[model samples]
Target: MTNSSAKTRAPLSRPIIAGVVTALVGFTSSFAVVLTGLAAVGATPGQAASGLLALSLTMGIACIVLATRYRMPITVAWSTPGAALLAATGLVEGGWPAAVGAFLVVAALILLTALVPQIGALIASIPASIAQAMLAGVLLPLCLAPVTGLALNPWGVAPVAITWLIFARLAPRWAVPFAFVAATVVVIIGVVTSGKTVDPALLIPQLEWTAPTFTLGAVIGIALPLFVVTMASQNVPGIAIMRSYGYEVPWRPAMLVTGLGTAAGAAAGGHAINLAAISAALAAAPEADPDPRRRWVAGLSTGISYVLLGGCAAASAALVLLAPPAVIPAVAGIALFAAFGSSVQQAIDDPGERIPAVVTLLVAASGVAVLGISAAFWAIVAGLLVRGVLHLGRR
Candidate 1:
């Protein structure tokens, strides 16, 4: 009896450790982008902290519920790409309240996708090249932050960049997380040298709810683009990754859970939560467990870790609030390098779609706003119009 119990406990340990690693990697890697995105859309520092906490709690709960129910290593995450879109779109016609409304709209759209099969099919019918091109365009300005920050604040940004480059060669998986570590160090040194004191009260986690106020411009500019990005870059890819790992995720339940999670968090400033993309493999892969059936333990562990990490959201947000200018943005940029590369690659992969894709990229990268709508919406419009014209009369 003792020997059998030991064997059972021994195999379980590996997956539990993998789950903790997944949460750590997932949280530390892109929380900066979330903060940056929230701030760009007119969230105050306190509000941004609230957003982080909301996302952490909601997605953590989501992972726990889905993984346990399906007995698969299904993980949920805050939408990193959607956050980037918010950052690029900036303050919309109706300010922060409007942005919150846009978040709610995205939630409704996601729920609709789950309830009505045609909605998901419509989103799926969007050309991959065009979708990826718009994302690439939106990401371009952000990816330039490190280069531009190096020029503007070399002392602060250099160390982060060097750390990232070193780890990128030695351990690619940890490069961005290491860069964030370096940035934290830089921020601490800056604080010490400048004799600035951080408020202890600010470190305590709290949610600040905003009553949403919808506007047409925000709907078109922020809500639509955010939904598209979350679906194309996060949710869809997340499903494909799980399928590759031999887990047939129940589509409706997954959508319903994430959509409901997004709705619950929207008022607290979270932009969106969706299925995990890049970090999905961390929990689902064979490395998580020799036996695939046991890997769901990792997913449960990840959820619990994230719930605990939610307690630190305020501290993380305070750090970003206190960091010297350009340092945080630099970290955010390094964290997104993989995503930007992937987007650009997919955007131009097809010879036939190259022109429309390029058109979308150029329009989105231009940062043009027409009558309060952001470049992202215009990029989609331009790409589809060009494609329709070029393919005229083709069967």
Candidate 2:
């Protein structure tokens, strides 16, 4: 190999830095949502903490093994959108146990897809525009958190917003990280000035395990929808991201590993663990490494960061719980801004699919819930129906 190739292959490079930051972004960006979703489904604080730790550790391990084995940048993440769906689904009949049962079912479905090649092909066959539209819709509400937060707490949010904007202009890749750091600073200052005595003992995460209880309602209403959303919105997009960056890794094995990890997490409270969608770009992009082949180091770095975060999940949860509710969402919005923009652009770019895409986006953004199902699922159904009708009319 040439000297340049040797230099690019060096470990602990800038790509690894980016990977670490990306992992932090992935956790901080949507963890609040995960907590909220779990609580809505009847998880106690301890159970939620356990779930967070479980998902993070398993996802971290998956990312490490897959990257090393395949020599590809394969990042794993908890399904943020799936968590949101669970939150929106509200309280189920069997509560937390039912949610755990649903999680197992979803993992089984993912494992089945991995074992059956046709299922993977079927997911891959989904129209990119439709998928993007649904994702755009799903993310739209969360993206608006900054705006709503600013309205609620200008003093706390303005600094973070400004930090994001400044860094985005001066150092694009660091925008979200900078914003989160700035927000943490702001929160710390508030806590200090307010004289709120927080006992350090509260940081200890109590891991709670809930036995799974299966119900037909949860299996259909929660499991099926969670499986579909995670596959279509996260895993498929993750594959697209890798392809866009010229990385080809086998999908089946990755699915199997993530599926098992997700099932393990379910017993502890996590909803689903799947391929990284938004953060995958950070690890796989040319910005990570000039030489595409060496970027697997980025995935390795991300995995290490995730494991550290898992170790501190309880403390992180405590901090988030203490912060202003709007603050967490605002920080998350900052991290997701680029993703929302890209999804929106792709969703509306094709004229032939525009109407259907719009339908999906609107329904998803509306946050409608019916029969314990989230709008994200119905948005795709609505979009596909419109597309079918349009196609028949054209014929």
Per-prediction RMSD in angstroms? 1.7, 2.9
Per-residue error (Å), model 2, residue 233: 3.0
lDDT of 2 at 367: 74
Off by over 4 Å in 2: 1-19, 285-294, 393-395
- Candidate 1: the clashing residue pairs are none
Pick the TM-score winner.
1
Q: Residue 41 in model 1: shift from native, Å? A: 0.8
- lDDT tens digits, residue span 14-105, model 2: 77897797798788766777876787788877788888898888899999999989988889999987876776566776888998999999
Worst 10 residues of 2 by lDDT: 4-13
Which whole-number lDDT from 0 to 100 does residue 306 have in model 2? 94
TM-scores of the models, in the given order?
A: 0.98, 0.87
